[model samples]
Target chain A: MIDNIEIIGLIAGILTTSAFVPQVYKTWKSKSAESLSLTMYLVFFVGIVLWLIYGISINSLAMIFANAVTGFLALLLIFFKLRFK
Target chain B: MIDNIEIIGLIAGILTTSAFVPQVYKTWKSKSAESLSLTMYLVFFVGIVLWLIYGISINSLAMIFANAVTGFLALLLIFFKLRFK
Candidate 1:
């Protein structure tokens, strides 16, 4: 039961991390970061980075995977923000 | 060093969770869920829920606090989405 729960957590993490793709794609395609605040995304990126480090420290693959993908998506958004705005 | 790092993680989690306030407030005040995607928020909500459960299982307060606040905010967003749209 516990293992099943963990597996669900891992799966959920993956899905959420992947869900950012559409936003990333839309932002990239439109060249618009107007709706996305730079400060917020920057801080979010940093937070996720720290979370990734924390995940590694605890040897938690789920956390690491989730944060890694999230960080990547956030970075893309940040890049678009800088590029367009 | 480790304790300090964890503290920082906890603080970051809090700030990020707190950062969602403006979005929630705006959504609530404007009564607009046009910019927000329901499916995304719904999926994100469930993901955060699982993350919270995982955090509790592993005895990680940082994750718990972060996801709890995030889930609450997401729930608010969902409520707005339903009410407005």
Candidate 2:
């Protein structure tokens, strides 16, 4: 049961991480983020950055990993939005 | 110092949860998810679901709240996608 739950957690992490891929690809391909929300991304980037710090403070590897990657992706979007806008 | 970090964490939580809102609004208003990837949403939905479960297991209010809202938003997008597609 424990192992099963761990597997589920792992799956969850993988899914969320990969889910951003399409948006990443779309932004990368079009060099446009007009459809994306700049305000939201900026706020979210800050939030994820905090989460990363929290994860680090708490020594939570999973949170650290997930938020770090998500933050990176969010940052990429921010970059494109600024560059293309 | 600790209080400040808590504030930061709270802001982070809020940002991530709210980040899904614009996408939700856009999807709702457009009645289209042509730019959104179904596969990514489905996977992210599952991941958030697991995160919710994990939150429950750990009794983490912040995780539970954030994931629940995000999952709900994701579900709404999924519903729109299915209905419009």
Candidate 3:
């Protein structure tokens, strides 16, 4: 069973991952990404992919889960940037 | 010494953490946060703070380094949001 720290990590993972939800929603609704930084998101997407690979290697549930979800969110943001452009 | 995977994790950490530099720079230059989502950044900041604590508990250099940097960037974003307002 996961201990307290891992549990803390898990909760942190959940918060960070879910943090993207509102962003995606707002961007989707607005269909305007003028203020969003494409370069930042592109670099960040690559970074999350690396983090995902790293997470898999380490087998940390929190890392894996958080990066996986964050990766998707980054992709969605990129998609919104492209579509809105 | 750190192994291959941890090194990969470290690189990922640097990339993701640095991803915000361009954003912070652009925001600082423009001094406009209209399209930026305050909710997302605020939530993300709290999450990263938890991540910092969790990383310290686990003694994971990658996590600690990443979250520490990302947390600073997130705060910068929030500060821009408020200041630009």
A-chain TM-score per prediction? 0.87, 0.80, 0.92
In terms of TM-score, the best-performing candidate is: 3
- Candidate order by TM-score, decreasing, is 3, 2, 1
lDDT of 3 by residue, A19-64 (tens): 8898898899989987888999999989899988987886778878
Tens-digit per-residue lDDT, A1-85, candidate 1: 3376568668868767866676677677777655555676677778888888888887777887888888988888778879988
Instruction: Arrange candidates by DockQ, descending.
Output: 3, 2, 1
Q: TM per model?
A: 0.81, 0.82, 0.96
Q: What is the model-wide C-alpha lDDT for candidate 2?
A: 0.76
Pairs of colliding residues, candidate 2: none
Candidate 2 vs candidate 3, lDDT winner: 3
Question: What lDDT does candidate 1 reach at residue B79?
Answer: 87
DockQ of 1: 0.40
Any runs in candidate 2 off by more than 4 Å, and if so which?
Answer: A1-10, B1-8
Name the regions of candidate 1 deviating beyond 4 angstroms: A1-6, A29-31, B25-33
Position B4, candidate 1: lDDT: 64
Q: Chain B alone, model 1: TM-score? A: 0.88
RMSD of 3: 1.1
Runs of candidate 3 exceeding 4 Å displacement? none
- Cα deviation of A29 in candidate 3 (Å)? 1.1
